[model samples]
Target: MARAGLTLERLTLEGAELVDEVGTDQACVRRFGVKVASLYLHVKNSQELKTGTAPLALEELADRAADALAGWAGKDALTAFADA
Candidate 1:
């Protein structure tokens, strides 16, 4: 069953973390659910799920980098972005 407050965006974020924890080749819907079918409702398929995570990861990383770079610029922003 879907979590009490789960949303597509949240699921994508979690999936991205799962990929980082595991490896992209091993991060499938079954990694998050008992059955592949269970993930159909959340993602179209394994390929789509992985595709979803890519943009989500990029957006999340960018946001964190931006937050870390707040009130900074140039070299500081570069450091923050690199650290993120």
Candidate 2:
């Protein structure tokens, strides 16, 4: 059965943390606190998680930049984004 709250986003974030903590080779479903064979439905292995985290990281950075630049424009926005 599918876990009640399991989703790609949570898995991606978890994978990112796992990779950061233990490196990609060690970032497996064990971190989910279960055997988690079902995790294969979302990702085949750690390499997929590593690749998946890239887009998540990019999106987060984009969102933060947008938020930080929400009130600025032109050179000010560029500077804020650079500083961000």
Q: Rate the local accuracy (lDDT) of all candidates.
A: 0.70, 0.75
lDDT of 1 at 71: 88
Candidate 2, poorest ten consecutive residues by summed lDDT: 25-34
Give the per-residue lDDT digits (tens) of candidate 1, residues 1-84.
753554666667777888888776245455555355655666666677678788877887889988998888899888877887
**Which tens-of-lDDT digit does each residue in 1-84 have in candidate 2?**
776676777888888777668876345568765555778666677567778788877887899898889899999999999877
Candidate 1 worst ten-residue window by lDDT = 25-34
What overall lDDT, based on C-alpha atoms, would model 2 receive against the true structure? 0.75
Q: Clashing residue pairs in candidate 2, if any?
A: none
Deviation of model 2 at 48, angstroms: 0.7
Model 2 residue 80 lDDT score: 91
The candidate that achieves the highest lDDT relative to the unseen native structure: 2
